[model samples]
Target chain A: MITLTHVHKSFGDNHVLRGVSLHVPKGQSMVIIGGSGTGKSVTIKSVLGLVEPDSGRIEVDGREVHEGDRDAFLARFGMLFQGGALFDSLPVWQNVAFRLLRGALKRPKEEAREIAIDKLRRVGLRAAVADLFPSELSGGMQKRVGLARAIAADPEIIFFDEPTTGLDPIMAGVINELIREIVTEMGATTMTITHDMTSVRTIADRVAMLHDGVIQWEGPISEMDGADDPYLAQFIRGRADGPIEAVR
Target chain B: MSGLLSPVAALGRSMLALLAYVGRVAIFAGATVAHVFRPPWYWREFGWALMQIGWLSLPVVGMTALFTGGALALQIYDGGARFQAEFAVPSIVAIGMVRELGPVLGGLMVAARVASSIAAEIGTMKVTEQIDALVTLSTHPMKYLTVPRVVAATLAVPVLVAVGDSIGILGGYLVGVTRLDFNAAAYLKNTFDFLELWDVTSGLIKGAVFGFIVALCGCYFGMNSGRGAQGVGRATKSAVVTASVLIFAANYILTEVFFAA
Candidate 1:
């Protein structure tokens, strides 16, 4: 449902995405694995048009991302940022129902609140938690709230940016499991970027290893373990000494 | 020879950077004004901004005006005593507070309080990706954030200046009666007689311009802030500094335009 063709981006001397090309079919979970600063975030952001690519094309559902009404285009997708990125001034329910309370997807205030609570419950958060601010919640609960928000509008596509970063192992596992279950239930096309191997195993139907500003390897999750690519081998094994450099 | 040219090159580079910075800020201001006229106005956000930039700012602005007015009364009384012109205290205090001190000091105080806060809040939001989150949620960050604030300050600061001017004149009145031993009714009469409509209106116009500069500096530095806590700190500092300097500079130009012969 989403496609990026030979996309290139740079920030002065840093050529973050040299020429990245990838595609995710409808209703599939595509987890992009890459080390820090390999342009994984930039890749997803390019598709979302959050960060405009210097060159090349990005399309979602067969239309250019930057061509049509921005509000309408963005309405079809949701995102969970690494920092949760919930509005600090808003309560959890308001954050979850943000899109539903504004713009084209707007609903009545009462209906929006009810849907926010329902989505909160779907992510294992109690309805009581809906009144609390983001800063009042723990990191794990904040992540769940963010997840609830990502799925709140029942968007066709969802992007999870490092969904497991800064969480304890148990919390990370729970988030990964919740993501897998929710993505499956919603039948939503998803693009998740993370270096968390456990999250990759639990959440990805397909995996793409990104390195050196390009996709080094991609296939089904089952084939990722035995892929003969040296860079993929170095990454999945977590070896310090290999084709992937340990030092910058 | 290269050493001799190095300083000249550095000056040229600094000039270019300053020009570029001014250009970017002008464009940002233009875009914010454009968004203000467009549809999809977020009244909730606008209401909150009005509360922050207007209502909440009253205490500091009031206190500053009061103290400055009292001090100006004392100085005028003392200085006028030397030339047998002590009775001129009331008129001078009223004119000074209404024309020069009211909007300028009020704008500076708001710049310190509001500009820094706006910058820090928006800068941190940018760092944490709330801005990008807003975008993905089909909200324009400019419309949702900047327009409300700029519009609020533009509309609200003039009101603040008017309030501050009255309170400041009251302060002078109190000092002239209680401490300077002037007749209360005569003091108020002189204050009213000397203050014209243009004196107060000119200050209000300056207030609006200063308010625009304060919020614009805050939003501009904030939206363009770099990453992390340190970046937010830098943005806050830059916002206050820019707003304060702009207030003074704008105050001078405005005074020249209003009162110059």
Candidate 2:
């Protein structure tokens, strides 16, 4: 389980996160929904130690992550970045097996390649594509490769940052389904940050709406449509005029 | 008048912003160095960086030295003839190449080729969010990406300087024996006699420092690069310019310290 307590982050004078708190119990999928630039990504990055909070506490599996142990803490989690950040110089297989190829998790080259190929297969890619570079693949294919790389080590926790941002609806649905399947199979604690309602409906067990740097509403995916909160209602309906627009 | 001052104020703000960014870059470069000696070296990335920054840079470094040596000989002979001290050509050529031109021009050529390439490659990766990806994957991007290149550059440039110095002297020898009316044995003797251990050592030392500067500027500008094509272009240009300037500056300082007499 990962817990964020009173997380506050600011970029100069812009207070992106103001006393934000959230929790994801083990083996649960928690989706954070928010408009762009409302600190959704910042929140996830803070948990992963990508963005150091100005003041907060992020605890992973009962281990408190302060200043010095971020790398050790992050090793327990897998993340799929928004743009599918695969290394271009490396072939697809090596990109997937990067962690396994070095340091404490070092494995023999052939064994690592085998593991990478299996992950690729799990993500619905052929063995041949493993030797190709990320640039050689289509956008949808790249996302799948990113997914394979994320799950290569079978992390205890997973983070998906804007997983379906640029994909077509069908591809988005496919990725969401894959995320759902992987989370269920691995029984991992998953936190997905996305603005897409379709993704929330497909992948999220519980959805949390982020507004004004705070989680305004959170509940089961089934309860999202019936949410009585005006913000949630306005967001779900995709309306032009609501309490949200009035703030502008 | 007040309206006109607004542009000047904006310019000042931009300069201050740039200065702050450079300060952050220096801190990041120091962090990269601190991570370098730590365990968990990325041999795959290190090997790739060796090939990219060093081995592949050979042709340009070699060619620049060869041609510069040839030109230096010709110019020295021409100038020496006017003073009736033409006999000093071979000795002067050897000293010039080893002392000043060999490391300085070699560093600049590398600054042009290797520095720009490093910046562009890493800058594009930044724009594409590969560095962010590394961070997300429990990998320190500086340790994985920048350290290897910096190490490769630091270790490789000294060897390059030694090779370049030899090739440059050979170029002078070739031009002197074939084109100029000079005795091969005497020219070789003069070069051997004029070249001292300190001259060559100083150049090699300069090479190492210049290499660090080159790789540092490249990685620093690249990691802090803005997003887009223009951002990459700016990063590449700044990397080369800063590397070249630093090489020249370091060359003078090292030379002064090594041979102040």
Candidate 3:
């Protein structure tokens, strides 16, 4: 279970997250949907402790996220960045197995490579693609590699940032399906940040719509459709005119 | 009155910013040094950095030292001829190359090549979120990235300085015997007699210090670089400029401490 209580963050004069508070029960897929630059990434990063919140508390499993044994805390979570964030200097297999190559979770090189190849296969990548660099892969393949890397260590919690942003319709559908299967099969707790409405339909167990740094509407996906809140209606209908500024 | 006060305010701000930069760089350098002595060390990254920073930079530093030595010998011989003192060419050339020109020029060249590159590579990584990825992967970016580079530069530059000094002395020797019409045996004897152990040691020490400055500036600007292409470019340029200036400043300070009467 994860919860963010009155989390406030600001960069210079721009207040991105004013007072965001949300909760997701254990082993549930909670997807946060908001317009671009609305602190969606910052919200997830706060939980991961990548971006420090200006004020508020984020707790995972009733323990403060930033307290006691940082490495061990990070080890329990996996994140798939919007840009894939694969290391250019390393081959795909090495990038996927990066956590296993060094530091506390280090494994034997051969075993790490084997596990990397297996994860790659799970993400629909062939074994031979392991030797190539990230630049050599297509956008879809890179996202798959990023997904493979996020799940490489079999972390308890996985966060996905814009999993479908740059992908084609078919590729996006495939990624959504992969996310669904992984969540159901592993029974892992997940928090996905995305603007793609279709990904929300496929992957979310419960959906929370964030606006102006606060949760405006939250319910099971079945209830999201019937919700009468004007903000959620405006967003779900893809209207340019809404409480959320379109220009932002 | 307003115009005069505005400039004063601007000057104050600039001074404050410079002090802030100095403080940040000092702290970064301290963290990098602390990481070097701690465990979970990365040998492979350190080895690669040694090759990239030290071994790959040999040709440029060597060429700069060599040509400067030759030019110094020519200038000394010509200038000494005005007073009918051409015999001073070999000794003065050797001393100039070993004492001042060798480490300073070599440091500048490495700063241009190595510091700019380190900044660009690391700044790009920051933009693409690879640095955050490193953090989420449970690895400290300072340890994983900065330590190896600083250590490599610190160790490699002294060796580079030593080699550059030898080649520069050789350059002066070649020009002295052939172009200046000085006897080869006499030129060799004069060079050996005039150059002291302290002169070469001071240059090598300066080289090590310059290397530290280059690595520190590169890593500091890189880790603190803003986002996007412009940010990366700005960081690269800043790293080279700061490294070169610091090297020159350090050179002057070291000379005063080591040789001033």
Candidate 4:
């Protein structure tokens, strides 16, 4: 479970988040949808303490996000980066088993490899692909590898950033389905940020729409369609013109 | 009056920005040093960096040292001939190659090669969010990336400089014996007798400092680079230029420390 209270962030003159607050209940799939540059990624990053909020409180399991040990705090979470973010110098297996192979959770090399292969299999990747570099993989395959890595340590919380971006429709659907299955199987709380409406429909149990640095509307997916907020309606409908300016 | 004051104000602003950036780099350097002593060290990354910053740099450093030594012998021989002092060539060449040229040239070569590669690699990583991924995975980027590289270069470049110094002395020997018509025994004797252990140690000490500067500039510019392709390019360029300038400046300061009364 996570809660953000009155989070505000800014970069120079451009204010990104202003007094934005949201709560995610435990083991729920909460996807934040928004237009480009609506600070969706910043929100997720703020909770993870990657982006320091100017004024706010972020709590994970009732403890402040920045409190306690960093390694212990981070061990509870995993993230699938937008670009997969695999180390080019490392082979696929090493990338997937990165945390397992090093730091506090270090395991024997063989054990790490075994777990990496198993996670790859869980993400529908062949065991043989483990030795290849990230550059050798296709975009969809890379996303799957990112997925495998995110779930590698069996984290209690997983964050997906633009998981379906740059994938073909079919591949996107496959990733969405895999995400749904993994979240259910692990019972992990998730906070994903994406502009993809289809991904929201497939993966979200509850949805929040971000606009103008605040959560404009948020509720169950069923209620999202009928939400009267013009900003939310315009966003879901993919309109170029609305109360929200097309260009910022 | 406003027009004349405008240029002064602009200059003042630029100077402040430069100082601010230097302060940031100083803080980053301090943080990197702090992380170096911490646990969870990445030995694998350090080994890779050693190979990149040390072993891979051998051929270029060797070649530069060789050419510089040969050239130094020729110039010293010609210059000594003016006062009928051509016999002093061996001692001069030995001192120059061992005490100055070896480490300076070797450090510059490594800076050009290793520094650029590190800046480009890490800069691109930063832009692509691999660095962010490292943090998310509970790995400190300073430990995983910066400390390994800085430590590797600091340790390895000295060894490289030692190797370069030997090859450079050999180059001077070959030139002095063959082309300069000096007897091989006499030339060898002069080289050995004129050189002190302090000379070699000082150069190697300079090498270590130069190595630290090179790697620190690379990693610093890289982790602080802006966004996108142009940002990476700028970081790479800045790394090389800054590393080169620091190497020269450090060389002078060290020379004064080691030799000046």
Q: Identify the leading candidate in terms of lDDT.
A: 1
Q: Mind giving the per-residue lDDT tens digits that candidate 3 earns over B1-261?
A: 998799899999999999997898888888888999997788999999999999999999999988888888899988998999899888888788778888899999999999999999999999999999999999899988899899999999999998888888788888887888889999889888988999889988998999999988898889989989999999999999999999999999999999999
Off by over 4 Å in 4: none
**Candidate 3 ranges with C-alpha deviation above 4 Å:** B1-4
The reply for model 1, stretches above 4 Å from the true place, is: none
**lDDT tens digits by residue: candidate 2, A11-72:** 99999998888888889999999888889999988887778899978887767666566666
| Deviation from native of the Cα of residue A225 in model 4, angstroms | 0.9
- CAPRI quality of model 2: medium
> What's each prediction's TM-score?
0.99, 0.93, 0.97, 0.98
lDDT of each: 0.94, 0.88, 0.92, 0.93
What is the CAPRI rating of model 4's predicted complex? high
Candidate 4 residue B170 Cα shift, in angstroms, is 1.3
Among all windows of ten consecutive residues in candidate 1 chain A, which has the lowest summed lDDT? Answer: A239-248
Tens-digit lDDT string for candidate 3 (A1-248): 89999999999999999999999888999999988877889999999999999999999999999899998999998989999999999999999999999978999999999999999999999999999999999999999999999999999999999999899999999999999998888888999999999999999999999888888888899999899998998888899886657774
Q: Which ten residues in a row have the lowest lDDT in candidate 4 chain B?
A: B90-99
What are the per-residue Cα lDDT tens digits for candidate 2 across B122-147?
Answer: 99999987887887676777888889
Give per-residue lDDT, candidate 1, residue B200.
93
